[model samples]
Target: APQIGPFSMSDGPANSGDMVSTSCSIVKGDFPVEILWLHNGEPIDQGNQDITITKINKHMSAISIESVAARHAGEYTCIAKNRAGNVSHSTSLTVN
Candidate 1:
């Protein structure tokens, strides 16, 4: 199974137009791991210009928001899956 580690975000509440980012990493897992970001249980829209998803490395993935808006405030989750199994971690974003 895949074990996730060090899932985190910026230190404090974010303001409108502020940039926010988070990272998800797999501490123990098999190869060919798939990582994804979701907002309130729904997949994030990659088509949005302000959103950027990056594969930091083989075991790490990151998502960044160039300009956070009111609608951006919600539960953000990072899910990792491989042939063995899957795991997820979630964090909340507070926009001011």
Candidate 2:
């Protein structure tokens, strides 16, 4: 479930034989924000999968899509949550 707050994310289009970059947008949250990424309803994060958070700020974030491939296609959810509230969004990734 996508948390609540000020947070957003996106994985750039399939590299198409090259690495791709994903960008995120954050609006405003009541408190701090936590970003959680899920693929096919599965937790995807550092030290676990081939995903990494490249940049994160007060209201925005960007991620790098590495080794783009066909199997790397799915849904990505960005959940932002804090002591105040929580929010979430999702995007689709297609590699061909």
Candidate 3:
């Protein structure tokens, strides 16, 4: 079974025009677990201008947004999937 660690934001609350990064870790899973990042229930592209995904290691990954705007405030979800099963973690981003 795949187990996902709790979601975490690099900084506390973010303000408009600030860069933000959110991360999650996979404790145990099949090799080469696939990771997906979603904002407000929609999938985010890998090399989007405003957002990007970074794989720190086989077990850790992060999503970074540059110059966040009001529209960026929402629920962010990190999903890890493998042959055995899948797991997910979510966090809310508030822009001031």
Candidate 4:
């Protein structure tokens, strides 16, 4: 099973056009863990120009937005999965 730890996000209640980021790390899990991001419970598109998702390390991943918009304000979640099971963490973004 996968166990997630130390999920973090940049300072929130952000202003429009501000860059923002969030990250998730797997403290314990099988090798080759896959991490995915969701916005308001919906899958986020990795092809979006303003958003970027990158692996910080074998056990960690991060999502960043070059410039946030009102539509981007919501609950963001990161899910880590492996052959055993899955784990997730979430945070909210508020735009002013």
Tens digit of per-residue lDDT, candidate 2, span 1-96: 223333322345565555755655556655456666676788777774466775467655666666767776777777666776666677787877
- Against the correct fold, how does model 2 do in TM-score? 0.71
Which runs of model 4 end up more than 4 angstroms from their true locations? none
TM-score of each: 0.91, 0.71, 0.89, 0.90
Score candidate 1 by lDDT.
0.86
lDDT of each: 0.86, 0.62, 0.84, 0.85
lDDT of 1 by residue, 20-83 (tens): 9988988998989999889888898668676789889989998999899988888889889999
- lDDT winner between 3 and 4, please give it: 4
> In model 3, which runs have C-alpha deviations exceeding 4 angstroms?
10-12
Measured by lDDT, the strongest candidate is: 1
For all candidates, the clash counts are 0, 7, 0, 0
Model 1 residue 40 distance off true place after TM-score fit, in angstroms? 0.9
Tens-place lDDT digits, model 3, residues 1-96: 578888665457788889898778898778879888889999998767888889898888888887998888888988889988788888999888
Ranking by lDDT: 1, 4, 3, 2
For TM-score, the strongest prediction is 1
Clashes of 2: 7
